[model samples]
Target: MEQSGGPRGPEGNEEARAAAHCYRHPDREANITCTRCERPICPECMISASVGFQCPECVKGGSGTGHAADANQPRTLAGGSLAADPRLVTKVLLGLNVAVFVAVMIQGDRLLDELLLFGQAATEPYGPVEGVAEGQWYRLLTSMFLHQEIWHILMNMLGLWFLGPPLEAALGRARFTGLYLLSGLAGSALTYLVAAPQQASLGASGAIFGLFGATAVLMRRMRYDMRPILVLLAINLLFTFTWSNISWEAHVGGLVAGAALAYALVHAPREKRTLVQYGAFGAMLLVVVVLCVVRTAQLTG
Candidate 1:
């Protein structure tokens, strides 16, 4: 077909020149075609390709994948970061946990009494007097990010380092972060239910366990090996059961919550995946809140 601004063929033989125009700009002349799709593209619409220039569509699809991705735009994901920087969520979460741990170390033993998950229902409150009477519920979320010991934070962060990137890349930053936090909250909720109200508990282990459960479930859906994760979980569970100090309730709660959320996220319908996943997670959070409310009622009653 004759392209815009294309000259006549030599010797008046118009059939000798096969002209192609840019798909987007039908009026613009295009000589070079995309290597992947073989679509004609004008220089203005071309992007630098390893071999040759590619059309905008080919680049958006990812350099390797044939399918197209969304146009270049920053999207909000978990932890309120732009979509391109999914790793940022993981880094920030890890950084916060480390910073809190450092603060705990510097502040000495008193910090745990103030920061640990201590229910208002406890017979004798361990957290701050203002927190207990004022219904400072932030402990559930804050406790998930706080750790007292070097080895404890190190182990949990190590688990996050191994498990975080893949999940972040797959689920996007926001969803992954939501999973981590909700699982942590669930852990605190369960700990509140079973542990003594005055009992002091703190650490990211609950959140870490949640990540473990999510990774294991997602891997199973992908037909990936689950043995390693299962063994790890089992060993950890054994430690929780055998150890005098370990909060088994929190571990169990986080594992169950993470696995449930992972299941919802993985099986969510492709048509409304994000909506369904978040809605389902919101329902799960509601359940946690209900549990907290009921547990608190029992304590107060």
Candidate 2:
């Protein structure tokens, strides 16, 4: 059965947080229309922030808020639970990551040794070794899918189970995939920049963090409160800072790149969405080029 709720003072804040995650304005009186989704935004949940009366979408796309909703309307996540369908891109990525992990484990020491090139051989002096290095260049993206350990993959995959579908549905197949790849590469780029010559890092935490970053962009764009994403980001960052072996550099880098990329791609007028997309795609390519050059110089120098 479909369930709905009225604004319960501060008690319903958790609901509000979840709504904000999906780009919905949840803290409001339930009557105002969101500037992006065109759904009714509430007064409590309305974001008249940097973008004015407009909702989150306007904020992301650089649109200003213009209209106000009547006081008589309602707000709800009660609209419906988002579908849980596995996105094609999400499934493919998960599958590839798991398959590679299993292959590495099965090959025992030899295979595992060979696959872990970047985490070991990649350096500021010699760069990655040839042959496998050529193949491993793709590791910038592939590494995001690869896991440092069994539990690492499990945790990331679980997070994907919750966050991936909604994001894919909102952005559609192609853009979703693009965001994941670019965000992962961004994480890799930072790892390359910040890590010591022998410092090694692996896993999809960076890309997963990118998904979190994109979620934040969507929330602001739809005019929802940024508190939820902000809070979540904070907690995770705190964990990153405290934990051992977690590449805080990759996490921060991936998140910044993801948010930047998502803003460039997701924020724009409907009329200009296409243009924004093309521009964002170009910009992402440029970032990759920059990373490649910097990596080469660092390795050769």
Best by TM-score: 1
Assess every candidate by TM-score.
0.72, 0.68
Q: Candidate 2 at residue 274, lDDT?
A: 72
Model 2 residue 249 distance off true place after TM-score fit, in angstroms: 2.0
Query: Model 2 off-target regions past 4 Å?
Result: 1-86, 117-136
- Candidate 1 positional error at 63, Å: 9.2
Q: Tens digits of per-residue lDDT for model 1 on 132-186?
A: 3237678888888888778888988998887786567546667888898999999
- Model 2 lDDT, full chain set: 0.61
Q: Residue 299 in candidate 2 has what lDDT?
A: 65
RMSD of each: 12.3, 9.0
Candidate 2 TM-score, C-alpha based = 0.68
